[model samples]
Target: MIHENPPLLTRIRPWVFVFDGPLAVGLALLVGISLVTMYSAASDYDGRMFDHVRNLSLAFVVMWAAACLPLPWMMRSAVPLYLLGVALLIAVALFGDIAKGARRWLDLGVTRIQPSELMKIAMPLMLAWWFQNREGVRRWYDFAIATVLLLVPVLLIARQPDLGTALLVSAAGLYVIFFAGLPWKVIAGGIVAGLAALPLLWSVMHDYQKHRVMMLLDPTSDPLGKGFHIIQSTIAVGSGGIWGKGWMEGTQAHLEFVPERTTDFVFAVFAEEFGLVGNGVLLLVYLLVIGRGLVIAASGASVFARLLAGAITLIFFTYAFVNMGMVTGVLPVVGVPLPLMSYGGTAMVTLGLGLGLLMSISRQRRLVQS
Candidate 1:
């Protein structure tokens, strides 16, 4: 008699998948709505940005499809995917398409892809896979090796002069290390050491990067230059105080008060037109997303699955927090786009890979249950 594999299409923790499916779909819808409403205003109805929205939505669909794969299969494949991602990042550094003074995209004939974005998903996956296989073998050398793995891509991305994405990517890698349950003392010591090295790190930043930090401190210093983006974003956000100015009625976006209105500054447009209630509701949905990811993380099926899910969850959280923080004048402008809602390809693909890992984990847990 031949044994049949459990139906891949069938319920793997039926309720778990359903809960995830709705949140994922809802996030996409909300993002899609934001694109339509914001682009109309930001583009002054030119509607050229519609194609960007369409492409991004398509990317989200791709992400959802990846998420449907079995978790163990994802775990098994994480290393190769990660290495490929790293190789791409390296390739971009040497022969990349430069725009706006930074070479961030690699032209693969049909697509101009950002490899750094791939690293965001790949780093956590790599670390999780590394830590998962380690199991009961806890050694400083293992930690060192994992740190090196994290550092390799981080340094390469940093060389691309993409400090923001590099920071976010590093955080994703660190999530795996932290969740591997390393000692508190070690974590604390690393923080202290890092703080001490800030001085040295600051000295090495590109001239423009320092200017951005300076601009963050005093945006009025160059109100018409680097400071312009922050100034406009703040006005947009503050203008939408309570119930907001309402949808297409946002003067900030409509009047061109915000730069990068469709991408990094989308939150400002969102806050301006939707106000506090909209912001709160959006945040609630994001929290639910995080909560679902956490449930997957804490389930403890395997270190690889748990670590990958945790890193991806934290990546989502970081994207939201960092983007909002920059928009509201609470954080430095590091060019981190908002998750889902931001109009960008690299970011969407990164999110997709992470979601795919989550779905894979959920599926594995389901199979084990059956």
Candidate 2:
């Protein structure tokens, strides 16, 4: 009997068949929603929509590439990746470009890059690796060392005054620390210390940062100045009520009242056009993704995989909550983009990497089972 070769498509497909099924489905759903919503948010339908599609395509490609890496490879890469991230951050601090008054980008004569975005992935990976190395001997000193590792990047990002990315990186690292069996008393003490340090934090904040806090408390103070974003976004959200003004019918967005409608304020556009019912559905999708990520974390085959997965999952929640809260005027405007919904390349790629890591962990679990 002649042995028939497997089909070409099947042979070619195995290399790309690495995603977690439910997570992939969830991401697809979000992307579909984003396309429809981007059409409405974009003033130039062809240009803006095309750019968004291009970024998303790149993001998906990155996600797939990330998913193909074995969990051990990822763990092994953590320290080197983190060290590179920190080195790049130091480079940014020394000779970075200034954009909108923030020194957060590095000009390498070829392209401009933000090193802080790397920490969004690197911080957790490094922390997970650290904890994994000390699996049986985790002690208070280990937690302290982890805190130092987490803080170095955070403080550097903050000095760059890219507070939004700093907050995200900090949260990602903290999640890892928490998952590594951090004490409840330590958590409570940290919360208290954070609260007590508010005065000092305020004193050191830049004028714009202070203004954002003030605006959150009273958006009407400036109306058309720094408060414009919060005021307009809140109007768009409130006017949508239950049923919304319908797709592409949001007066705030179409009339140019909603600033940054395609970026940080994309959630406002979504809320205005889709309304409460639409918001409910969108939130349900997010919840599904988060839930699936948590499941992957819980099912991970190793401590490193588990901690990294859990941290990345919670980071998703942080992005959504902070973006939505800022847009709704409940929180300060922190320039955080809505995950998978915003029109930006950096954030999209970063998030894609995160999802890809989750898929890798999930893939490892399945492989072990089989």
Candidate 3:
């Protein structure tokens, strides 16, 4: 029988296989190219699509570098990173330029940056670290304190009127709480309490948020206004039928019938061009990314590693699923992007951090014998 290497770095450095890293990279590359193509189609030959591709390429490189770094050091820096994220959020809230009736981004003169994007990683990282410290926190009150930790950022995010992002951050933190073996009874109790306090939450919701729910209930009531986005998206997706309209041929995108075609509604564009098969492929890529993540979680090297990796993994799943589901009329529309496939800076960085955690776990596994 042959034996694996016993050298420290030799045993550890090979963890990068990562369920066929080449295939994952190839698929990611294919998807990015597709997004760039869709961007051009939507732009009607604008130069901005080129810039989007450049940024996306840069994001991939950053993710690669992060994935190669060590995990313990990253976790050690968790508090500082979380504080930095909070500071950025505060900066955005206090002195940020306003756009589209929401103060969601900081104007860097050349480009706009959103801080809430960092919370997607920071929240999970902080919670995992918290659990690591309170290793024996097996009580309901401990879970409550954890919930408070999650709520603080959710409140800050909601104050930005970025409800979609607020919901996402909430989901990220909630994943940690749930994974901490939080009692099911407490969860059910919280659900009941939430339902009971629906009126209070509704009171705090921005007018536009309430209208989203209303429009979802009856798009026909306001076809030209709040309902327009969902209506256009459904038309674009449904028009694809079995075979799709073909790449760069979606009239919805070409004719500008689809809103946010290169961003929020990119899935609709992909669906319209590729039809059911394209959608199926997208789902497969997503499943592969998430499946590899879960495998890491199941065999993760430590509790912190497991929690951080698992939350990030499911958060990725949440991102793809929410974006696709919302675009397809199966879920309420929230502005969640489609992870690596979506064009954005903040989201890409978060995905990079997440990929780093997964790679960290994998690295630990390989180094186990060393």
Candidate 4:
């Protein structure tokens, strides 16, 4: 009289169980939009677009793979994953490959790898696990310890002179700490201390780093040299106006005025082609993705899931915000990519992994509820 149970994967389906309905839909739309913009930015049916398609396909593969793993498996993997990340980072620092004056990559026989990218996920996962273990017994000392854990790799990255990724990794870790209920006074004090140490920090910065900040203050001071990117990108966004120039008809990108058109500066191309209206729509979609992430976080079955979900969501926000802000001349260029939109294999993979983790958390919540 008893019925046989369905296969594990089949039981979770309707496909939404793995993808999470709203998040999956939002991602589809975002990816579609990204492809459309990339085509225009690319200005031809060529290898660039094909490469993007390939990268996106790989990213989804990663997402699906991560989603299929059970929550306990992910939780158990956190420490080892984090330790591996730190070891890789140390390896990068000690005997890594140097390209373009930064020692951020390890040449692993077949291919070069950037270890800092691993910390983007590992830093948050490690912190979330730590806080989950200390759930009810959190103290100021614990928060300080969390900060140290967060800063170790951050300082290493900055030493690579990759201030952008360092900032991102730090943000990811800090989000977990904030979600764990770190005191406002501690946050405030850290801010004050950072501000107070600005002079010393400035002295220690590499010339290029110093130049970026200086250019942010007054790009016109060296318009032909350092200010070129901000100036051209801002012009592209402004030229887009209310309704855009109508897709590939964009003068900025077609004319090659917008630098890094397929990568970090891709937002300028999107803005130029689609205009203010397109930008608005894209922003709304990003907000929706973030909203879905927060919902997942709030509904998570465990403290670890909640913290990880929230951190990943805000990391998406930070990526988009920093990229847009830099392109618009509101912030200094720090080489951040517009999530799902920018053309880079590594960034795409990182984003996919984070979303996969979010999907895993969402799936866990649903399982708990059922």
Q: Highest TM-score: which candidate?
A: 2
Give the per-residue lDDT of model 2 (tens digit) for 218-292: 999999899999999999999999999999999999999999999999989989998999999999999999999
Candidate 3's TM-score reads: 0.89
lDDT per residue, candidate 4, 303-363, as tens digits? 9999999999999999999999999999999999999999989989998999999998998
Per-residue lDDT value at 350 in model 4: 91
Clashing pairs in 3: none
TM per candidate comes to 0.90, 0.97, 0.89, 0.96
Residue runs of model 1 more than 4 Å from their true location after superposition? 1-22, 25-29, 32-36, 39-45
* Candidate 1 lDDT, 1-370, residue by residue in tens: 9987877666454533532554466566567556755575556546547766766767666666676666667777789988898889889988999888888889999988888887887788788888888999789988989999999999988988899989999999998899987889999999999999999999999988998899899999999998998999999999999999987888988888789888899898888888999899888878877887888788747777788788888988999899999998888899998877777666777776676667667666766777
Each prediction's whole-model lDDT (CA)? 0.81, 0.94, 0.79, 0.92
A best-first ranking of the candidates according to their lDDT comes to: 2, 4, 1, 3
Task: Rank by TM-score, highest first.
Answer: 2, 4, 1, 3
The C-alpha stretches of model 2 lying farther than 4 A from their native spots are 1-13
Backbone clash total, candidate 4: 0
The candidate 3 region of ten consecutive residues with least summed lDDT is 14-23
Per-residue error (Å), model 4, residue 184: 0.9
Output the better candidate (1/4) by lDDT: 4
Segments of candidate 3 deviating more than 4 angstroms: 1-33, 36-40, 43-45, 107-112
